[model samples]
Target: MRRSSDLSPEIAEEAAWWRDAVFYQVYVRSFADSNGDGVGDLEGIRSRLGYLELLGVDALWLTPFYRSPMADHGYDVADPRDVDPLFGDLAAFDRLVADAHEHNIRVTVDLVPNHSSDLHEWFQEALHAGPGSMERARYVFREGRGFDGSQPPNNWTSVFGGPAWTRVPDGQWYLHLFAPEQPDLNWEHPEVRADLEQTLRFWLDRGVDGFRIDVAHGMAKPEGLPDMDIRPQAPGVLSDDVHDPRFDNDGVHEIHRMIRKVLDGYPGTMAVGEIWVKDDERFAAYVRPDELHLGFNFRLVQAGFDADAVRSAIEHSLAAVAPTGTPATWTLSNHDVVRHVTRYGGGAPGEQRARAMTLVELALPGVIYLYNGEELGLPNVELPDWALQDPTWERSGHTERGRDGCRVPIPWEGTSPPFGFSTAVNTWLPQPNEWDHLTAEAQLEDPGSMLSLYREALEHRKSNAGFAGEELEWYGAPAGCFAFRRKGGGLICALNTSGASVPLPPGKVLLSSGPMDGDQLPPDTAVWLV
Candidate 1:
């Protein structure tokens, strides 16, 4: 494969650029705000191109920026073909793509094929055209089951809260695994398939390198829309083990195959799915040669900061993709979950654990998607009750706090809330006051800071040529420690998950997540050796 710096169309079409690539996930709404609307936009991302380039990421996976009602923070796409006015026009998107390519960075946007906004033209037409109309066939619209059609068609629950079926004024119930405003599409319809294919080509033609498909596992519902027999888990959690009839249906693979056919025509362009299949063999199906190029395995994210748990998570993730010849995608935090720093344990301990896991994720084969503020050791904000914006907040009867904490605008500069995120005092989500010390600018000057660790680590990974291949050789370690060597790279990555320090492996120290305790690797720390 050619270097990203000299990547030409010929090279792009022929090479697997995604493998071993480091992608940064940019939640556009919270990234930056050039127009000072208190919400990030395309131009804000453009202005930060230099910063991203300096960070040494190979590509960027952007969350949805399409025309949306913001019901699900851009996931409720009203028009897949156009940029939402909230994030600038089509020209701004084109410019962002151009600028990204100029910086030798690939750009991948989110594609939400599982559903569309209720305000979408197709859905609007369906609402106006009445029952049994052709337009209604585009989405999942069925009659309620009760005598007077008062009950839902099925007992399925929404991922957010309550019933998955939303009743319309016409006495019809529509399927929405997520929020009601985001109605699930009838993937069985030929028009839906054709339209999504068109949408894929539209962005690909505009120079987007690939797509991170949203809720990719939910595209194909079961034949009868059967009632799931399992008890519900916590809100917003979908485990394949739960046997939720709403997800991982056999028909989904056909949809992926169709998507892959379009992507294959564009060659090197990738289609990464947000697949949550827990069964290894079933998960492997999504990444087969004819389907998605990559399927994110969230086991690592869900694992605790303990040796056995972390090791098992890694082993499981690798095993799932090993059969398909696809590299496992690694990530710790994203727009949908609580930040890893907080999840690890929070405070100084959480930061240390999060920093250590970063090394583990990067050392692994395949792609690493770093959420926008993770490199800064940003913790999830404790937003005021009124500041919550996730639909789950209201949908869950105000019981669950939802994901608004993690979606807070990133701290770029300044010493207060909004930081450098916006010129306006009111940001869409409030930034925590404690984040002043964690701002990129504040951390840039400190060699010991989280941002510095990421920059240095990325630079080393790129220049050393030790991360070129996908082979890991595991080494037995002390009870609370684990180590793995990159095959033929003459490099080793070791971690100490125990409270007590452990002996450093035999090699020259390349990098460490924290200061070593003499010859010992400290607890909650990771180190790279050469």
Candidate 2:
């Protein structure tokens, strides 16, 4: 659309909001704790509306706050229709949505449809009901493999670790692709489909703008739940390299079509799927007109701090989504992975690379998701072993230290522990003392700080006409460096990934991720120009 003609940013945002919106991911429990209970709640998020508005995000993708057992930190849904007591009641959630909209920030919520908490009434009923009962049919329950019915139904393993099956007291086994406490829902079941539709209606009626579907690649298993010859992902990676029978099943498309039908009833609402398929044709299928409005392509997040790797990621991600006529989505970190700062190389150098990367990301053409505290240049906190809580940790027999580091409560404004996140001294995960210098309070006033750079970059991305483009054209650059111009707006974005500085592109400098070296872009730094 941008290449064809100029559309005011305001008009474009209204016409198709998800096309170019910047969404901030609020990982609920660690964002802000309102009642001083040491865990972030709905009220805490409502209180932070002003901060988010000031940060200039178009929407807030709040992670699940539904009635959960917290077994998977809210991903384990017990009651999808109501807010958990820990996060306050439905009234609190409604208030948060209303307040967020008042600040011009649309609210999207996480919807976990792949599985239900084992404590869910249906699952609990399935436990006691006979093997052939209708309740059992709502889940993927199957008979055991061996003669004694002692072995699991299949050799498949959980993404968290161990076997993907768990045995019941009745001697039958059920599939659980993650933790045993989370039982996979039988998407083929009419009751399950109806319930999910009702769920979409329930949340939409409550004013939720859209949904960020969890495990969007999962749900529909192939007929005769088969075995998967899987390769174990490396440590700290819940990686997706494709060719796993566990996910990205062809049957899953019909599920997305059903969800799309429900979402279509609400004109302004959208659904963005967290798909992990690597085949471009298969990945593109998830975003077809009758499917998800947006499907997250994580190629960029998996790339290292190298220019060639980053270039390849962008090109492939763009190509993957091109067939569907959907805009590409870009992100560097999320609640599940190690933060980009630490991944690039920890300490001052890491922060510099992160700042440079942020500029590069913001300059891109499609939807962008920012993990909370990323704007403040937060790095993964190496918490003591005693404090780790990710399910991956216990499931892997403590051999793997899961994602607790990136999920640490972000520092808001104080110089000590909790950092004004909560009035309580102890938090869900202890905050490191080193964060005294990285708190938002400490960075807001510093022009050179990461927060300030983010603010400046966001303002330009939102208001500057030069950023109006649906795609970018590559520009020739020196080795270990790459540059691109937004196809329509002529906005130039350049990154110097090499060890030596390079001359800036010929344009009016708009912003720099680091201090400029005369007329040059410094090593490991990025810049935006018009």
Candidate 3:
């Protein structure tokens, strides 16, 4: 096994660093805390560079840490160019970028282009400037419906629940696909496009490696703010339903093309979009040559733990990017969604399946993103209702528990709450006491731990030539089992999703998600044979 720094000079010379890369998604607030303020910050991330390097990741895809009022954590950006005081100043970010590069790790920050915080200077000015003013033109402000302008401008509801259009004091209604504090921008407005382009250049000029565009499919709306034919079954979840007129509109391609033009000016810097369009044809459009370098297709994330479901997800995801020749991004968990550990089942079974899926995911030929705390076999924290902070909790009228479960602070080195996440006893989101056994500190010493499994797998993926290539050949296997061979690599990854044990193919066992019975793979387990 080889470290990321030991990659062959030739392999590292590829112009696109993100292709076939393993990126670690750092949800800034939950990653680490150097300030003892019970919140993670840029300094904390900088201090943990060595840990990430040891884990063998090629890059860091950090979620937003920009200046905001915490309306939706950092997703609602008040200032794109400035760092939030809670995270650190611009100097701190510079230091983080400098140190991260020293570890041979690339840094990609989140870009929330779909909307801006209502507290943003521009949005505030728009509010005071009144409707139809140039200042108001930056956002999607419109007139209301009904005789007396009493109803919302449109029938579209927010992903976070309630009406998508919020009525302002001056009688005009503004579109906010998310929370009311986050007003959707008018992409058709030249000023809005210019401002976002400037924001991209600002971060790129600051030495940030790239950006992960938030709501990439959502910048542009149809000619008319038309009402969708469907309603979201669940509030705040990115709907995969194609009838969602509010997202993945044809106009969004132009916005992406403009963003791509800005990115093209800065060579080697990539732009990845968080696209939720289920249609492969539409999803592929965002990653067209003149658009994003990669688009996040969530088929795998939404799949069940069954073998057929996983296979279908992977097949669809691969087909989505086959035409473009770009790397297909694979992710099992992120800041949103239930952690894979919990999603698979819960205790032993869940951890086993999570580990199995990790092998399956990493084995695929593409860029893999591992969410923070995932390598530690961390499950979602079931927080008390009083501890919930996700905007959806209130927006959904408390009917939906929201995403706070997966955003808990990571357990670094200790055996109790906060672990080594912070010196302060109280973290922004409370850590579960049962996480003592799963801390990085504890796992590092256990050979059978998920941390060790990930370290070994990543190192192997980096060092071994067998993990190369984009083609996967399916091998005939028993029912509920999936066995696929790497096109040129002689590497076979097999998963037994059945009730009974399955016989292994002829090869040396390189890695197994769990203890195996000689050459037999038990149910809910995966193995890499070479």
Which candidate's lDDT is highest?
2
Candidate 2 structure lDDT: 0.90
Of candidate 2, the 10-residue stretch with the lowest lDDT total is 1-10
TM-score of 1: 0.97
TM-score on alpha carbons, each prediction:
0.97, 0.97, 0.96
Task: Give the alpha carbon lDDT tens digit for every residue of 1-530 in model 3.
Answer: 12235456565455488898899999999999999999999999999999999999999999999999998999999999999999999999999999999999999999999999999999999999997899999999888889989898778988887788889899999999999999998888998888888898888888887899999988888887777775446332577556788888888888888888887666667889999888998888888899999989888888879999999999999999999998899999998889988988988899989999999998999899999999999998889999999989899899888899999999998779889999999999999888889899999878999999999999999998889778999988898989998888878999888899999987999999998989799999999999
Clashes of 2: 0
Candidate 3, superposed: residue stretches over 4 Å from native? 1-13, 232-236
Superposed model 2: Cα runs more than 4 Å off: 1-15
List clashing residue pairs in candidate 1: none
